[model samples]
Target: MANNPFKYGTIVQEPYFTDRKEELATIKESLNSANHLILISPRRFGKTSLILKAVHATKRPYIFINVQRAVSTADLAELIVKETLKRYPLERIKSFLKHFRIIPTISINPITNGIDVTFNPGVDSNILLEDALGLLEMVSTKKERLIAVFDEFQEILTLEKGIDKKLRAIMQEQSLVNYVFLGSQESMMTSIFEKVKSPFYHFGQLMHLKKIPFEDFHQYVQEGLSAVTTESNDLAKRILNITGCHPDYIQQLAASVWDLLNYKKLDREADAVDTAMTQLIAVHDLDFERLWTGFTKNERRILRDLATLGKLSSKDGYATSTTYSTASRMLKAGYLIKTETYEIEDPFFKNWLLTRLS
Candidate 1:
């Protein structure tokens, strides 16, 4: 067990080790009652990690599938079959292949000793979906429950036009398997699940994953910092204040501080922390450039205004103004986050903007 407290931009699955206990309990309760669920959050907010943890804690057989790269029905079916067969025995897999009407072929490599199972596409794509559902239903019958989590579920909506309706129909017809649709990109996710006119409307429980509490984070960082050097509370607060409870940024900032501590055992005046923050921003220069590259001139100007002035509203305070509308759209797209007194998104980018503008 290393003394590392930051799991930057990665999934943490250990129950006793993670901090989202209440969210896990809510998911567990929903799964226990056979309720379908949709977990939503912004990018990098630990949705995948939380879903993986929930599936691990569940009292049923579960299959996890990542469809972020899937573009068609064929891709979706292939990924599902591949993950499902990984847990079954050869004989069972062969038996399963018969239900799919596709032969299960295995390949052996003499050099690497790696085995690969290849699935022959059946006569039609519908058969693939049917067989997948059948396999899940069969497993659920014998195992009491079966949970299938589709990560990056919003991508399914982008798959051809009618695919969303088709997939919804398949899930709606299922009586045994429980689905956990997990996705970031809050606006798209809401459109998929919350729109009354959509096929997936009212299909599952909506759950939003929030950032880890400040108290929990403070304790975690304190323990990690204590292991290296005796830093003051003010230093830790300053670091967190800049990161604003973003898990990835917090971990990254802490890792930078640890690297500084490695060189000099202690620094109590906070210069090391400040230097680490500066280096972190400098190292991420390309990220801001990429973000700016994707924006229109007006959008970029709106962002620049936020970066310079900290918040924005119409000069006339009218909701119908172009400024208000543009700002609202950017907020929904996750380009800006509106707080009580400020509008800032991506703390690192904000800091970078201040430095560049200054």
Candidate 2:
């Protein structure tokens, strides 16, 4: 089989996962106990993938809803209803919809060869929440726990009006379902989950999804490549050195390298891996550009500083110009990461910015 290890911008499954056993176990334990969870992580750290993997492993009727683009209560409700219906038979879905008082005008078209159901909220629009809750309750009453995973949940706060409060109330009253709130934007997630004044505060256990340990990831890369007869520890280390164990980046680089070495001799030279990493970045230039466009000037400056200084805080305070308040904000925003002695985040972007700025 061809070595196709890359899964950039997609969910990672079990066989493709590198490390994260402990974190996965924690999520499983929480689900087993019927406890809700909030997963917060920096972007591209595999938060979505991990949750998807958990959902697949749970062996339960679960609904994964991406609320990133959901700007209204109706959109969220519709998405949940649609995903729920997708998991069951049409008759069961119609029955469930009836219980929710969501009277979808059902019709069949000869061209489509499927039933079309359109919902109209009518006067009592707030009943949507009630109906959604009722549907979940019914699903739960079926002796199976329903898990609703809200990805990019921070977007809920972006709703025009006070929808967050309504969502909080609905989620609080949901006795039959478990909620998993996943957010890649750390600042938004923490504000929603950690701030006492926020409606979602203390609603669930807070969990952060971090990068897999370097050694374990290296092992996985080697083994995955070995399956296609193009394995090399040096290639794995070089990829890690550039991607810094970022799961998506690692997969992308590995995929590029695998394709490059298809039925050919492995590049054993020290600089060969570096060349491959460069090519990977060049091939995915548009992705990196889009990522860079999301950052503010200060955030970009912080990244450049890290790339140049090779660290955030040093004994001599080399990058000391970045004030404590700014650092804290950046850290909260996931633009910066702080360790006991070192501080850095998004190693790939840092390198890219540094190179561009220089």
Where does model 2 exceed 4 Å of error? 99-102, 106-117, 121-125, 227-231, 263-270, 283-301, 313-348, 353-358
lDDT of 2 by residue, 1-358 (tens): 5547666767777678767889989999988775799998778788988888888888988888899756666666666766676666667766777666556565665897654444675534457656765676676643678888999998877764667777788778777788899997777788889989888889988898777899999998877666544447877887887776777778877776766666454455444455666665576578768977877766555565577776544334435565556677877766676544334665555666666777
Worst 10 residues of 2 by lDDT: 311-320
**Native-referenced Cα lDDT, model 2:** 0.72
TM-score of each: 0.87, 0.83
Highest TM-score model number:
1
- Prediction 2 TM-score vs. true: 0.83
Can you write out model 1's per-residue Cα lDDT over 1-358, one digit (the tens) per residue? 3445555767765522448889989999988876799999777778888887877877567888887866666667766766666655557666666766654466665887755544565446666666666677665663468788999898887766777787888878788888999887777888999999899998989998887888887777666666666663655676677887776677778777866765664445467578887888888899888987888866766777777776664444434467778877887788775445435568888888888878
Q: Each prediction's Cα lDDT score? A: 0.73, 0.72
Query: In candidate 1, which residue pairs get closer than 3 Å at backbone N, Cα or C atoms, i.e. clash?
Result: none
